[model samples]
Target: MNYYKDNVSTNVVTSNCNYVVTVKDWPAFLNEYNNFSNTTLAAYNAAYLQLGGGGNVAPGVSFLLKFGAFLNLYKADPSSDEYMPLKLNQNNA
Candidate 1:
């Protein structure tokens, strides 16, 4: 998905740190699954849990996927799944 371009419309600094929203009918949902401000990692985990438990099967605003949750936790290795400092550790080892 072109998750970057559109989300920047909302906030650029938080764009790279955002999670993609796959729930198609989120605008119709409520409670713990409604607020746009619910961008924490915990909130993101909750949403995915709900989906795994048989939530909606449709795609929401395809453009707003990365706009739902905040994803900038720790630094990631740009070239791999390892943490950002993994390469440094490897070299020193």
Candidate 2:
């Protein structure tokens, strides 16, 4: 089954934040999951827990798989995962 994208959030700055519903459907799912407003690591853990069990075989396998895909994508793209620190050139600029 195709895992549809859903609510996604990212933090532009560090602070306690709330998730804004950036997108509602497929297009929105991709857009928002790729780009977020204020979702936290702890929040993600909680969500994962709420999903029941771990791995793609868990209760909400589809949803978890979609999240896993987004996580991979987030790791791959710099502009996407703001939580990731930019690698600074060792040479003094």
Number of the top-ranking candidate, with lDDT as the measure: 2
Q: Which candidate gets the maximum TM-score versus the true structure?
A: 2
- Per-candidate TM equals 0.19, 0.26
Question: Which 10 successive residues of model 1 have the least lDDT summed?
Answer: 84-93
Tens digits of per-residue lDDT, candidate 1, 53-76, equal: 434322222122333333222233
Which residue ranges in model 2 land beyond 4 Å of their true spot? 1-26, 34-36, 53-93
- Evaluated at residue 6, the lDDT of candidate 2 is 40
* Tens-digit lDDT track of model 2 for 1-93: 243344454433223322222223455455755544457768766666655444434222424344433332211233333333222233311
What lDDT score goes with residue 1 in model 2? 25
Q: lDDT (0-100) at residue 51 of candidate 1?
A: 53
The whole-model lDDT of each prediction reads 0.35, 0.38
